[model samples]
Target chain A: MHDAVLRIAGLRTQFRTRQGTVDAVSDVSFDVRRGETVALVGESGSGKSVTALSVLQLLESTGSIADGSIVFDGRELVGLSEKEMRDVRGREISMIFQDPSTCLDPVFTIEDQLVEALTIHGTARSDARGRALELLRMVRMPDPETRLNAYPHELSGGQRQRAMIATALALDPQLIIADEPTTALDVTVQAQILDLIRTLQAETGAAVLFVTHDLGVVAEIADRVVVMYAGRVVEQGSVFQVLKDPRNPYTAALLASMPGAVAGTGQRLTPIEGVVPSLLDMPSGCRFAPRCPHAWDRCHEADPPLAAFDLNRESRCWLEVDGAVDGVGTAEVVG
Target chain B: MTTVAEQPDAGPTGGTVDGPVLEVEHLTKHFPIRTGLLQRTVGHVRAVDDVSFHIDRGETLALVGESGCGKTTTGRVVLRLIDPTSGTVRFDGQDLAEVDADELRGLRQRMQIIFQDPYSSLDPRMSTADIVGEGLAIHGMASGQAQLDRVTDLLEKVGLSARDLRKFPHQFSGGQRQRIGVARALATNPELIICDEAVSALDVSVQAQVLNLLKDLQTELGISYLFITHDLNVVRYIADRVAVMYLGQIVELAETEQLFTDPRHPYTRSLLSSVPIIDPELARATVRTPLEGDVPSPSSPPSGCRFHNRCPQAVERCRHYAPVLVDLNDGRQARECPEYRPEPFGLTAQSYRESELLNQGTEAGE
Candidate 1:
């Protein structure tokens, strides 16, 4: 396996609310290897976004990374000062958000934003414009020269996202953390963006820490998959291993819930019976036990660790521990 | 608003209605953009332009499109929430445009709409009972204890407990809140329910539960649905027929399976190919011809074919001659583009021809 571009171990991010402190991400561990796309897959409030935010140390004032080690490019980033982190942010590990409209300053033109991204990282102002134009053309932004002067609002959603990607790539960052970057886009536009990212990643050899709720997108783009539920890593494996033969009950149920997973039309989707438990009042045992059909007394009484069942395949399920066969048992559990 | 007693004798379900429950023809909605002190009309944003479709009894007809394609506008116009600039919406064989206010109100009881966001759609101030029972009281169907009873039944029907009647919208989860929305929509026993991206905001598990609930309700109540959404996967799961909209125009309309298997429109094919497949192998293997460029502004769409600019197979004729929907006589309709030729089975015409050439080469070698 290639060297990990970014490694996160025992990451526990917490938010201090008025009522109490809630652990948004608990013991979430994953790694993004060089030149590979690792998807942090989860539903809303699954703490996938928190994990991304924790890596960049960009958590809101109320939130903080309580514990964990985030090693980026063989350097510790957990206790880095804000000044030091800023130096690392745009130059080494760039981030892309769900909405490009909010990320791009409405007042500034695309050229100004891209040029600023370059200048902050020590590129000369005169040279930044040429680099910005090159980045725009690299991202396949339509009419790059014309779009460089266009304000964020003037550009279409796809164009704005392309500009955002260009800004992220302004310094040729080694790692890209994209949080649901294509969720807000139309399907066609999403496909285009996904294609662009894949192509650019191949060209630049930049590792992507892709976070998304859509499993279909994960399948489309990700080489590896890390499934999170209630701030815990429920499953982590190669895309085919996790998606085609998910060992964790939560992962299986999530797959079954998707309309595309089922055969034929109007078939009843095997839905997980309950909602994701509130972070404050999470289950004492397995967080997904309440919804898992295969959950037994052991599942409700003790939380299972993310145990490796095969090489490079891990699942947080008691069933996997008991040597349950792959594919067959998971299907029955979903049923 | 008059009481039910003072209202006319004609009710929505009073007569034996024939044909489809909802028939929309040439529905067009244009918002006039004003830019001067006098507020003079500068130009019209044609949100829904010459759109037409129908929903049969107990059938789901999904209006699928990208954002700004005007599927929601069509839904609103069909419900007469927004009056159409030019079109006829026939509900139960009565032209909605010609109907009086009182008549429209009476007809509205049989039509309900569920919005996408469960968070904002429900009144946070009102309890579940008030939210669900409001429609009942407004239509003069039930009141007081009787209204509570009906609301309770609706709650149970939509997979909620009777105890939830007194709870506020905030007390419920997103899926539960959506269930409340469904209950409120069903409170009036509406024949045609317009679900405008109803499950788009939900989690996958929650979405499945809600979709199953909706399907069960349709099976039981024979309720027709105008399911408007941008999610093609959901459309395939829920809709019997689909109308693919582009720049406020219905470019293609066909049965769900037929459309998926043998799409005749270039836009539909591109749209289908763009949807990320769940299977990893299939997702990677499928050749995707993703439509380039964002959808053009509805205010100033492309000259002839609205999709011409982004279309991969655009030709000279597509730029000058606007295509009209042509019936294929197989319960399907697609815009008549001369350049569009239906591919054989799953392969595109280009790839199929390449494979044929490869096979011929192999034969020659053999």
Candidate 2:
């Protein structure tokens, strides 16, 4: 296999709120190949965003990556100094944020921002504008000449996203992390933006680690899927294996709960049953145990480790530890 | 009769009564684009143009499209929140456009809207009780002890506790605030609701709860829903029939099952294909026929099919002649498109397409 561009091993991040520490992400890990798309999907508060931030060492002051390692280009990122990490960021590993409306600087022209990124990354003054224009075209933005002078606010929503992606790709980074990049875009524009991301990745051979709650977008471009729940990866596999035959109860419930997947439900959705446990008051066992329909005594007594789920997948469930294919067993019904 | 149980699970064919509770005929809303310091109208944005659909009592009719596709505009016009430039809106037996301001104010209780963003919709300064009870106070339905009772009842009905009444909107989560929004809408005891992306702002888990709540409320109260959303999943879950919109017009309208299983419109097919499935294998394998270009501005739409710019199967006819919304005789339809009739799959059906469409009508009903 080609060397993974960014590999996270046993990563964990926690937020220290007023009441207590919230395990926003625990024992989470994944990798991005040179030109592949890896989607991290989960409901809100599932720690998907925190994990992304942890990779970049961009977590808020109150948030901390409590454990594990982030290996970028075979370098250990966990112990890097803030200043050193900053140098690597945006040049070697960059991110495109969720809201296209606010991500760009309102005062800066698209040219100014892209050139600044280029200049900071050590491009010569004469080459900055040429490089910026090239990056814009790389993202498939139309009318590159006029668009370069436009401020983010003057550009349309899709234009702004294309600009954002251009800025991220300015450094020719190895991995580009996108957090709900299409959430603010309309469906048509969303289609356009996702296509732009895929096309750019194709031409540049850059790995994309995408974070989103909307599975619809995930299914469109993701080569691998990682399902998060309450700060832990409940299931991880190839998009086909996980989405077609979800091995975890949480994954199944989430699939069944979607209104579009099934024609119509004769019975109510087996919707995980309760709210996510507040991070301040993390549960003793599986954080999802309270709402999990298959939770048994083992689930509530001890936290399960991420183990062999399917041949290619891994799930943090004790019930599936023995590699059961039916996605159900006696231990699955315990608790 | 097309009953769900008695029949072979045909969608929306029914033992239940079907008649218009809400009828919109040729509705149009044009927002003028003002430019320069003079603020002169340079052009008009046809946010909703000659759109027509009828929501039968107790049924959920979804207006679905990409954002800015005019679904939200149509939802607002149906409630008369924004005055339509021209159209006839008949609610029950009354003509809504003809009603005076005073009479329209009285009718607000019969029609309500749940906004997309719960955070912005409710007043941050107001407590939950006041927000939900505001409708009751406006209609003079109740006050003081009665107002408190009404608000409290509304809270429980939306699956929220009465204790949450003292909390402000910012104090609540996105999903909780949406529940409060739903509670506020129900305070009027409205028979018809315009749900404008009500569940889009919520998490998947919380969305399920809210959808179930809407379903339970629908069955119990016999309320009709004009559900507006871009999320196909939620539409499939709640809608009885759906209208697929693009560039301020409905391209197709039909029962939900037929729309998903056998879509006639190319745009409709693309929309269904865009919906993400949970299984990764299917996600990878499913060939997505994604729309290629951005939706043109409403102020400057395309000459022919608005979707023609991005549609994968555009021919010369699609560029010159604007398709008109026409029925296919079968249960499903394309609101516009010359290829309105459904030909059979075989070579013989291709020879007599109109006859094939007529022949399919019985199969659709059965």
Q: Best by TM-score, which number?
A: 1
lDDT of 1 by residue, A149-225 (tens): 99998888888999999999999999999999999999989998999999999999999999999999998999999
The residue-by-residue lDDT of candidate 2 on A136-176, one tens digit each, is 87887777889999988877777888899999999999999
For B236-286, candidate 2 gives per-residue lDDT tens digits of 778999999888888999998788778998789877766655444455566
Q: Alpha carbon lDDT of residue A40, candidate 1?
A: 96
lDDT of 2 at A262: 52
Error of 2 at A44 (Å): 1.4
Worst 10 residues of 2 chain A by lDDT: A326-335
- Model 1 clash pairs are none
TM-score of chain A of 2: 0.93
**Lowest lDDT block of 10, candidate 1 chain A:** A326-335
Provide all candidates' interface root-mean-square deviations: 7.3, 8.4
Q: Can you give the lDDT of residue B188 in candidate 1?
A: 80
